[model samples]
Target: MSTLSLPPRLLMGPGPINCYPRVLSAMATQLVGQYDPVMTGYMNEVMALYRRVFNTSNQHTVLIDGTSRAGIEAVLVSALEPGDCVLVPVFGRFGHLLAEICERAGAKVHTIEVPWGEVFDPQQIEEAVQRVRPKLLAIVQGDTSTTMLQPLAQLGEICRRYDVIFYSDATASIGGNAFDTDTWQLDAVSIGLQKCLGGPSGSAPITLSPRYVELVRKRHHVEAGIKDSHHHGASGSRIQSNYFDIPMILDYWGEERLNHHTEAASMLFCARECAITLLDEGKDAVIARHKLAGDAMLAGIQALGLQPFGNLQHKMNNVVGVTIPHDVDGEAIRHTLLHRFNIEIGTSFGPLKGKIWRIGTMGYNARQDAVLHTLQSLETVLRQQRGPITGTPGAGVDAALAVYDENRQ
Candidate 1:
């Protein structure tokens, strides 16, 4: 096989944003044994760093050795038993994903859905929880499919009142938006390094409150080969998937240093550096940067006379969904932007496919230059395609600059 080679293209999409150079550099470092002192130290540091990133004091913060979905599945499979009732509030694609995973875990999944662009009201969720009296509430904090961020603060309280375990998949919104795992009373939260963390996808950093830990521990089971006389079998049925067993994963991460699977060391390094970079910049400041970039993108797109998808008030700070103008072929425009301009934006999924464009301002790409360049290149591509262009040339750039200037004060 030939050595790897790739084209240079700007990723301005909903996820897997360009990694921070520092994170890439970190990942390129030499490897160490999983139980090596230095490796374990780095592991401990990662747990601590992510606690700050999630704004939680939970002692159970650790990286699941897979993608964000792995973390989601681990939590659901460990916490739920067959026929257990799980309530999912579906606002967009990820919401549907949670319900599907829960069902696969043998949960009796009950879902309440809002339109793609809208978020659920706390009262609405409370009403559903009271009616269902579910064992758990699983939801997505942000769904890039519609560029919407569901409000989770009040839902936590509702879950607590109803004695429901609250879990959120914050893979898309964690670093760029407000998420207080402790303050919001979220029992378990899972996140990915790819989105606002400015790292490549692989590691899933998750935090579980003490209550969640206790619940998961009840279902813990040692692997047959690793079992000892002291090791008791799981109180509940063995979690369906051995690889996704959270208790075993936690033992691997904890001081016990028990082996579950070999740690993905490079990805751990990448995830660690991503958290370090965010904390060094200050979480509040990083979130503000994303907000500014998102605002600028929104203003620029509006100046170009394109209406944005979804309710503006509930949109995520990391991405914007813009309506594809009439008479314009969305895929052709996206292809032109990628090949001709060396820039990439995303297309919508499911019901929104071909109807809108998803442009992201996230991680390292959440900068003035990236946002302006995307807008400028898009305008040029639209003009070339003879697509709708209601505003005068350069209006988008001017509007974006105005937002930057205003935010500078």
Candidate 2:
């Protein structure tokens, strides 16, 4: 077979965005033995870095070897015993995913859902938690499916009051949004490098509070070959998946340095570099940058006479959802944008499918030029599709520029 090659294109879509250059370079560095002192040192550093990225002081912060979904499964399977009750609040696709994963883990899952493109009020979630009396409350902080970010601040308080363990999949919103794991009282949180962190999507960085760690340790089972006489099977049922057992994974990452699967060295490096870049830039500053880009993108779409989907105030800082015009073939416009302008935007799924296009300003792409270029290309594609354009030819660009100028002041 011929050598592999890739095209040059801008990814302005929901996730798997361009990686930061430094992260790519770091991933290219030489590999090391998984148990090598140098490797372990880097591992510890990664754990420390992700703690800051997650805005938590949890000692169990570490990387799961697969994608973001792996981290979610690891947390759920390790913490949940068969027949354990889990309360899920579903607003979008990812929230549904959490419930599905919990169900697979043998948890008796109960869900409360809002319409797509809408977020739950804290009261609604509290009321549901009260009714369910669940052992854990699982939710997604942001679901790119409908481009809505559920407010998590008050949910944590409600969970605490109701004596429920709180967990969130922050894969789509972590770095580019306001997420305080400690202050929010989130017991467990998982995130990916591909979103606001500006890295490729293989490694999942996860953190667990002391309470979560204690619970998972109860299910710990060492491999047979490595087990000493003192090691015992879980007091409860063993975790459903060997690969996703958090306590065993932590043993590898923890001071005991017990072996788990061989770590994905390159992805770990990339994840570490991603955290360093975000922390160096200052988390608040990076979030502000995303907000500015999101605002500009929204303003530009509005200027082009397209209505936005969802509650705008509850929209994520990293993505904007715009309605597809009635006369336009949404896929055709997206195709033209990718082929002609080499820019990629996203399409929606489920109820919103074929109805809205999702435009992202996230991670390394959260910049003025990226926002303006996307808006300009979208404007051109819409015009080509014979979609009605209410404003002047360059109105989208003008509107985006106005937002940029305002942000500068």
User: What are the models' TM-scores?
Assistant: 0.97, 0.97
lDDT of 1 at 284: 95
Residue 12 of model 1, lDDT score: 98
State the displacement of the C-alpha of residue 400, model 2, in Å, after optimal TM-score superposition.
0.3
lDDT of 2 by residue, 290-346 (tens): 999999999999999999999988999999999988988999999999998999999
Q: How much is the lDDT of residue 71 in candidate 2?
A: 92
CA RMSD per model (angstroms)? 1.4, 1.5
lDDT of each: 0.91, 0.91
Off by over 4 Å in 1: 220-222, 225-235
What ranges in model 2 sit over 4 Å off?
Answer: 220-222, 225-234
